[model samples]
Target chain A: MSHTRYRVMEAGEARRFPPEAMARIEKILTRYPTKQAALLPVLWVAQETWGWISKEAGEEVARVLDLPPSHVDGVLTFYTMYNLRPVGKHLLQVCTSISCHLNGAESLLERCGKRLGIGLEETTADGKFTLVEVECIAGCDRAPSMMVNDQYFEPMDAGKLDALLDRLSREA
Target chain B: MEKVLTARIGKKDSRSIDTYLADGGYTGVKRVLTSGMTPEQVIEEVKKANVRGRGGAGFSAGVKWGFLPKDTKGKPIYLFCNADESEPGTFKDRLLMENDPHQLIEGMILASYAIRCRNAYIYIRGEFYDGARILERAIGEAYAKGYLGEKILGSRFSLDITVHRGAGAYICGEETGLIESIEGKRGQPRIKPPFPAVSGAFAAPTIVNNVETLCCVKHVIDRGAEWFLKIGRNEKNAGPKLFCISGHVNRPGVYEAAMGLPLKDLIFGAEYAQGMKGGKKIKAVIPGGASAPMLTAAEIDDCPLDFDGVAAKGSMLGSAAIVVINEDACIVDVAKNLSKFFSHESCGQCTPCREGTPWLYKVLTRIEAGQGRMEDIDLLARICNQMANGMTICVFADAAIAPPLSSVTKFRAEYEHHVTQKRCLVGARAAELVTV
Candidate 1:
């Protein structure tokens, strides 16, 4: 609302550390001996503020942590957890690793794709969901594991998936 | 033999400090700090307990802690809990931390004390957002209760614990790669010679330990080393071990038992996996995470699920993440899937690993699609052999070869069938081999 107090209105371009986020960054800095070491956590805070790390978001992170943009890009691309582009409201990651593959992962992913009317790494037109295949989320104990944003849904099948997707769609 | 690491798992309010303390959680760390047991004594007990790492490598935890320099010349020692549990079939650490966060906290405190670490961090993978929140809450509780921070329990021992989440690089599980990630750099591993123990995390002497291994330190202190030696199949591989049984198991989950539980027993035992799904016939097993070579059904018959036991049969007990394959699965399909995983996860640090992983996956894909030549089978082994054993800065190249090489060796006939017959051999889509 007040453009005078903020550098820019965007999450990444204007790398605005909300007072709470700034406090978190300060506390994280105390955890490490150097400020640069707080880059990962600070970047995480940025990602949490924004849905994904855009080019401007990456540059803002570099500027905040005193790291070069190239370094931020390199670090951002290396880790799969950090999203490079905007994601839909819900991001579903299905595991197709050895354990999950043995279980019906391929078919499970196909079900999600067909039901959502989107292929792998695609977001629905309504901007409600994005489906992608991830390596492993350490839920091998319950094979055919899928992650809905941050929550783990295990032993996923077509029936459970349909019900779950119906519920997500029904939500405002 | 009783549950050590998983004792608090499945209990009511398990993640809370109140429940943890009521169940005697931090008593191990309290006993070590208050009982006048020197840091050296704690390290000695861990060494005697013979606790091997649970994160794939199975190296001795005590021996790893002992590698810290006797004199750091004023640099504060650091302790990193490797929570990057990305190994394909491993998920025990996630269960441990999610259910019993204090168990890991207590274990890290004891381990930090043993190594004179002033600052400790849990480098958890970012995918484990649930676990990170649980641990952050647990650590706050510990600090409020004086189990962590300055003058812990008024015993003159001071330490701080932080949870650093990895963005999502599998290589970060490698100790050096983890160190680099923590330093706000790419997850590419640092060259060895001056290992993490000598200089790591802010260029200070650091000790990186697996989550389960740190959790084991609490028990080694609680019950004493001799008591630990009595539980397992043998003294060399002792203490409670968590084996992650995935795939076609009827009751697939994390089963903790005395070390050296026979491989077949874990698969067919009443208490473990309770046999394969639909009583399907076993074909092959990945004895340890994706890194360890798979074992044929015959080779796994008398196999023991310990470091030395699994090794005796040709595969290392790398994380004890047992993934079973029944008669319905295709071996070529399995190898190709694993190769694709390796190709996707390669850190691109080494020439051979960066180039060779996708090459291996491409060849496997060709074979699985009924497009492989007979010579491609031998070529697979040749490509695998060149990528590992000092071919890279880290052992990642070595691990990327496990699936391809082992399958080619044990399931040669299956590979031959795929090439000669131009299709899979076992799955529903498989065509019968024609001898013309």
Candidate 2:
């Protein structure tokens, strides 16, 4: 509920994992003894191919791994990292866990909301960034940590996030 | 204390295998293979080393390996290295993995040989994408160096190490839950009787060790057991321990000291955290991770940062994640935040934890938001009791109760203030925080 909203079932099925991902999946299969056990990685490949895990995407993963669609749904909904629908290109995950909270993560979050013109779990008007409060990332040592998509930034404040947002916006 | 685990951490190119070998890494497993050190002999050496699991449970590593059946009925044994360190206020494992991954790899190789496991996996947290990449590179390096794969170091012993990343689920930190997640299911914990050692990871005998525990194993093999024994306060708590200090400490980071390092020394020691930030006075300290009970400032005067030492103070050093709270923090708000974490992470299996966690969160949410009644405080306590003990398959419910239960008991006046006055006790500093 705090992430990608539920949209109506799409008319047609999504495409299968791309050729590159299929190659990656082939290697991932060797690591696991069973096909079903590679479900998480295969689903991750699907998400990487398409920005999100659509119902069709789930079916494709199920078909690939020889699992039922319901099992794929169960796995998808249980983990928070997967995208049920499309998310912004840049996911601004700010930490609001106790350690970050003590280091003024709440104020940083509020600053992000004010600057982005969006509340929690909301993407900006241009859809460049989606801001969400995350749990304690292992960077608690730095406190008030945030991840700009994949890279971890430490001891973030309003100024740093604002500058980063400005730069990210200018690029695209 | 000798810094076996962290010795190569800050060195140049620490994560590379070249640096690792320069510092004599992978020698432990090489010695084990070339010298014909039997699996039983390796286990005996570890037992004599007296190194406890750096994971929360603090079980002796040797005793746990000894639990495997003598005759496995030909079922292939497996080893799972737990790198899913999502425990709030805990990040020590991330350090070892990111900075000097070869140390962990060598440790896993040694552990796999000791347990006669041919295959092993590192179940790292998905949020740690960067850490995972670093480990993947490190594993590749290890394989290229002939330290892993079949006929490792020219001996009959062979091993394969794979790094498996988990999607975001805190429950996966639980060993059984980890087993289930690696099996490609929702991270729900299994009921224990067979245990992971008996039936785990595709119905094979398995041993799940923490990142730090395995790292210690490599050192315990390199250094004799007697040298390992002399590192800590006692035989029960021996080895170099990585303490993750966060929150209001001036120099919050991972510090590796001998086991049983004094609590006050970590927070105020000149070589450690130094002191509280901005000259703030200490209010409460969570000695372990969020799952451990909170201790008042006065109670931590003589606290020792070890499994038993903290347990003696009615708190367990569950991962040695020290979260220091300054006087400006609202106790009710702290409890509310942690309760929300447990609520979000509950796998929703047991009726008690599934329902009780959200109930506790709701009441605390109301209380922290200035809508609580006087009865809500006691209701929080009653709800915690229902979710713990044998009521659930895993200790998650028990852990879910620690934050709220400990806060309400230790800081009842703060809760009372929030309820009656309809505001946080630290209202003066509320302007500095936006209260997300």
Candidate 3:
């Protein structure tokens, strides 16, 4: 395969991973009934340490989990949470379920799209916010809801959303 | 008027099938069959009631029923009841099946009649062993009573309601995936376009609804649509809903409440959630079900409990399984636990979900293990960004990714400290933290 195309975690950064984390990764390797079972959690740790799962980091998780790197890569790509690239600080998750749709969630999404200056799957240029249209957040009674940085903000309107952005911006 | 949704499970006396029949169980079937009520009238009544599907997605039940092709060339039509109550913090379906099996049977009969189907299947999860048995017994009872089987209620309608058990896969809760599993296939999702309405079980027209959704049909007809519409607080979305409350709440069971009720009232009010356990204040809440985004303390205040209200806040009013998070619970631990579930449950069908869930889990485990870095938090966010959008067949992939992404984003400093200081902020499972 071509090593030039894949992003590799730097050695300096790898060295900064807490020794205990490395030890725990080793422990996770032993604790699992099978090495493959440990693959997901190991990649999770790598993604945690690196901010995203790079191809190199994925290979390392694969090694620790005692599986092929390709297997790890496949698992990483299947879930929506495992980011392969960089993203902004605030992750905006909008629910686009049936109830949300009826409750004008689409309009809220449009407003968010316009304000964030990015499409549904696109991240902002400044890497401050990445707008995402997610599946049901399961608060149908509170339709037109959103999760900013994992905290639920209900009954959002244009005004409240703008304020939320302002607050998140300050925090970021 | 004891709200039927959360009534005692198999009270066996007053609420048993015999009691239910005495109180007019299978009467709807009789009424529909004898009263000459066409399927269109039943569907129209359901539409007027504005009844929504109770299984996570609040799609109108009547609208869904209307979608089935009016006429088919004698191809078997199927009515599927989603008894797969696998979503974490969701238990109402199990309770309903265990308690009032007759209500469900009647609902299935009515639903089957409206959809012009001969066979109906109640796909219960393997874990709900007792519930499945109860349903089988109920089906047997309905058969003896002549409500089900060839020539139901002595009318031309003959329906067979089968109780099929799932081998424990959450993806089977999805309609198409459920259909796939019903056919004895490996429970993975099929692409849309040939939706269940067009090509469902055995490639015949099918209608899949939650157990609660099917049950609501009985009420929508018995009480008339106006009475049903009057129950919910939201005019647009009507009908009573069951709130399954767990985690840190004083009353951690299912409660029936009008739609559009505020979350604060549900959580803090004396009779509702009644605050957290041990008299502790609620610090956070996963307002919908497990998959809904986590809610902070301030945001929990006065948030409405309906689909529209939840959507307004960028969340969803999913199955309405309210999971309360107390002050002491570490957000990282929450993320780690949720990550473990999605990772284990991933069908390994889609590339992103199959791989991303475990990767997200690893990062969360590392952080919880006191090995997180500043970049690790961002990396968590990055993976969540990638995994949370259109990456898989169902929302399970998104469900797995959102928690860690949200946790790291919300509590970055805590994660940063764990990495820098080499310790979990919370003492729970500290040894496991170091065990990789």
Best by DockQ: 2
TM-score of each: 0.95, 0.97, 0.70
Better of 1 and 2 by TM-score: 2
- The list of candidate 1 runs beyond 4 A from truth reads A1-15, B427-436
- Kindly report the fnat of each predicted structure, to 2 decimals: 0.82, 0.80, 0.00
Model 1 over residues B267-360: C-alpha lDDT tens digits?
Answer: 9999889998998877789999899888877788788899999999888899889999987888889999988888988888789999999999
For candidate 1, what is the total of clashing residue pairs? 2
Alpha carbon lDDT at B2, candidate 1: 73
Cα-based lDDT for every prediction: 0.87, 0.88, 0.72
Off by over 4 Å in 3: A1-172, B7-15, B424-436
Please give the lDDT score for candidate 1. 0.87
Which runs of model 2 end up more than 4 angstroms from their true locations?
A1-8, B427-436
1 or 2: which has the higher lDDT? Answer: 2
- Model 2, B30-111: lDDT tens digits are 7889998999999999988877888899998888898888999999899999999999999999999999999999889988
Say which prediction, candidate 2 or candidate 3, comes out ahead on TM-score: 2
Candidate 2 Cα deviation (angstroms), residue A117:
1.6
Residue A59 of candidate 1: its Cα lDDT? 83
Residue B141 CA error for candidate 2 (Å)?
1.1
Worst 10 residues of 3 chain B by lDDT: B427-436
Q: Model 3: share of native contacts present?
A: 0.00
